[model samples]
Target: MGSLDELIRDLRRFDRRKEVTNALARKVREPVPPVRKKIRKRAIEVLPSSGGFGRWVSKLSITAAVKLQGRAAGIKLKGRRKGFPDKQPKVDLRRIDQGRAAAPSWGRRGEGDWHFQTVTPGFFTETTAEADEWRKAAVSAVDEALGVIRRG
Candidate 1:
């Protein structure tokens, strides 16, 4: 059996593992990437002026009143409508079951859709360069945390 002091130190290290893991998780989550690029500004039109005076208006009926109320007439402006990805995949660290960290792809697989790839381009796999980078970062983080715990 280990000494009481050694056991206490081990317990302290175990307790701190969650904090270190969570810190690493936050780091992993923040840079995963946004779901999609912002829609093109050209698709929508914005006017600096709220539509200056209309060509025809009766003198008795106030045009200024109409402006104050809202638009003089309902101008139906429509653009090309389409579906876009809305949810950004997250880095979920499951401690209870598998005890592994993962950032799910969220079922975004398309040959032509580039935006979906931004969120999760399969960086978790061993075959990719990104995976190697992730491994280095994760290892570095855990080592740094262990060093802190040892020093403390």
Candidate 2:
């Protein structure tokens, strides 16, 4: 029969090897963050005539809206600041006018106005699989450690 000291030594060696293997496996199965996706504007529109003036207004409105949204989303605006001798540096006001004109008598008799819409995109990932795997591995490791201790 094996000596008590030899048996204890063998059990300790087996437990150490199991722990190292479990740790390595856990590292290999670790989850990583997903990459961010690009946001794209879906659609844009401008009211009033479809003439050159309307086209210009539409372009301006779309540009303004996109810039505004980007700024609100924490994007840095491209420009230099202005400073007065007695005042702090300030951002220059950027403006885009949506041109409006009076409708022809043949149509409505009121002043024409412009309208537009904006959109923002985002990215995401599901963590169900990663969570499940982590839980299973953690439970298994704990159970194995407990078994080893109980046997000792």
- lDDT of each residue in 1-152, candidate 2, tens digit only: 22223323444556465554355344323421111010011112333234342332322211101111122521121212243233323322122111223223443323333232221111011222233444444345444444554575
Question: Model 1 residue 14 lDDT?
Answer: 69
| Candidate 2, residue 127: how far the Cα is off, in Å | 1.6
User: Which regions of candidate 2 fall more than 4 Å away from where they truly are?
Assistant: 1-130
Q: Give the per-residue lDDT of model 1 (tens digit) for 1-152.
A: 22323323443546565665466445433322221111111111211111210111000110100010123321111112212255323222111012232222444434333231112122112122233343344445445555555665
Q: What is the TM-score of each candidate against the true structure?
A: 0.27, 0.21
Q: What's the lDDT for all of these models?
A: 0.28, 0.29
lDDT for 103 in candidate 2 is 27
